[model samples]
Target: MKAILRTMGGWSQRAPTCCAVVMKHAVLWCAAMLFAALIPVVHAVAADTSLTPEASAAKMAAEHLMTAKIEWRGPSSSPKPLAGKRIAIVSCCEAADGAARASRAMVEAGKTLGWQVNVLDGRGDPQEQNKALNSAIDAKYDGIVLEFVDTTTVSDGVARALKAKIPLITLGTLRNTPDTIPDVSWDYAKHGEALANYMIWKSNGNVNALILLNTDLYVTRNGQWVGTKNVLTDPKKCKDCKVTVKEWPMANIDTQPGSIATAALQANPKINWGWCFDACMSRVSRALIASGLSSKMRGAGFDCNAESLQLIKDGQVEAVCAADPREWDAYAVIDNLNRLMQGQPTVNQGIPVRLFDKTNISTLSDYEMSHGWQGGYDFRAAYRKLWGMQK
Candidate 1:
């Protein structure tokens, strides 16, 4: 019995003295040892958050050192004159406020260039978008611009346009696939990282973040979350940060963001920061206040829409990553398409993204803030001059 006990490793220390009890106790000891062996495996699957306070501070310092300013890189010069060209503007949904504005901007740019522009509203239906593309192809439009339409969903339409040798450009949709043309949008991952970095620094690297995601917008939405998680979970970037993600169905954002955010905050009272992928969903300001966490928690997100900018100015939101989905994005798309028409290699027109906070919100005029802080730049005039619309 003593030799068998020695073979049991540390289980021998807990062995029963009586022979009758020995068998029962040995079975329980074996189960306990098996469970203990699995604990490390479970922990390894989770995010590693075991950094010393000193190490965390050092990591944050490195993050700060790497921070840089955002710059706008619009077209340096417009492509050779695009006079007498016929352009088709296909809008994903005119009911979508951002898409409407972008469509208008594209039409205005086409007018400035003496081009006949045809506007097609997809009405948020893929079939309608397909019809619009087919119509544009039949009409022999010189170029086509798509606003806020998922390229993958319209892959067949895109293939038809490509086969027709029509130059196509997409705006406000993140498409890295080869089937699509040049996509004019901000770097969503970088935008998300900026928001996360702000929260981490503001909380002194001790942040429990609740990320609100819109899973409907798959690529851009997930890309933003990836950036946020990468910084929040990395021990070298934020040692004391913890992240919990909750995805809201796309249809629920307009009406349910407040309620969903309230429930999430109530369930996880330790959350010190709330990060949203789109500023439109950041309408949870009232929910944050109602929970009495207004003073304790800070929120940041993308888009500098009117509500979000006001929240930032009023101290309800900590930061907003601003991009001009209304105008600049459309201009970039037109500029690139023009380049492609002129036999020049199309380039990714770098749209600028700025983080707006209380400190700088007051400095912006009302018009600028209302336009999502995009009024500060004059990309329209610059592009117009490049296209030779102005001297």
Candidate 2:
């Protein structure tokens, strides 16, 4: 040990001095080993807690969806239409743009099937919707399409339709019970996540966002609220993000969004992003402009309504998630009903959604922008081919 210490010390004068050198060397060796051992631990901590991985993932996912080429992703069934079939639509609210679009598209799609389609406006009243459903039932329509109306309000009428043995499907609504009714609904949660991702990617991991929701709709409660919360609050995905959620009653969804947005912005100046769950972006956009926040705060949501598209075109909003065109959605409903009429199992229809923003919105003509992503490819032709209606 003395000889080793002396060599390490380069020929120290005394044994005690050599011993001191040995002790110093021993301490340094232990420290080196400890540091080497801790290197992996340091990296592991960073891997577990760092925000880069989740942010990167969000960026890639958001970009892919933003630029994805739309096409037919639904079924390929060549189901022929039943002869002399009459279908009725019970619209929850003709005032709502989405319901109106669905009504128009359903009528058009019905013509392709050579079926007679009737629409009864619910006028945003549950009692009206119930009465409409009963009217359709009384008329003995072969099928009924419930548009944007919650099933809860028309449960009795739904039961009556079931008792009457009519094939009832829903458009832009969820199927509450499995295998009971076919619903041409959307993955609203996916829509919400797309919005969240857009904010994340645009904000670059520093998002202070406020999400507006209408608790009355199942689409908002079961999907958008859940999806947005999951992403914005996840530490792995967004380390420097703050999400504030506010509820807007369905009754006031159209009219009160602007005031609510103004209030929220006034309450929290740190919020850089504001997102509505649907086409209420019109009101929100107006509020932002009025508040002179269009340059500071960004807005986003679903339903590419004409006003929303114009806002996007004018750069008032950052982005919006657009679902399958109402035509595609209406045809999907018809396809589901056709399957039921033919005694076949109903399919999910796999409707596609895309994110639109300033980067790509200008490519669409005014008509196309008015209608949202008119099926990136020739989806109507494809659907017609699936129905064997393409002449």
Question: Taking the tens digit of each residue's C-alpha lDDT, what string does model 2 give over 311-353?
Answer: 7878875455555566678878888988887888779777777
Estimate candidate 2's alpha-carbon lDDT, on a 0 to 1 scale.
0.77
Candidate 1's C-alpha runs over 4 A off are 1-72, 92-100, 116-140, 286-297, 322-326
Best by TM-score: 2
Least accurate 10 contiguous residues by lDDT in model 1: 59-68
lDDT of candidate 1 over 1-391, digit per residue (tens): 6776557645646653464376678889999999999999879544234544534454354344233344556656656676899999888767545566677778887787787887898866777887888788888999988777777767788888889889888876776445447777777776677667767666667889877776545445656777777778888777778988777654455656677677877787787777774444456776667667677567776666666777777777445443444577777777888887887777767776656667566756777666655545677777877877775
Q: Which pairs of residues collide in model 2? A: none
TM-score of 1: 0.73
**TM-score against native, each model:** 0.73, 0.81
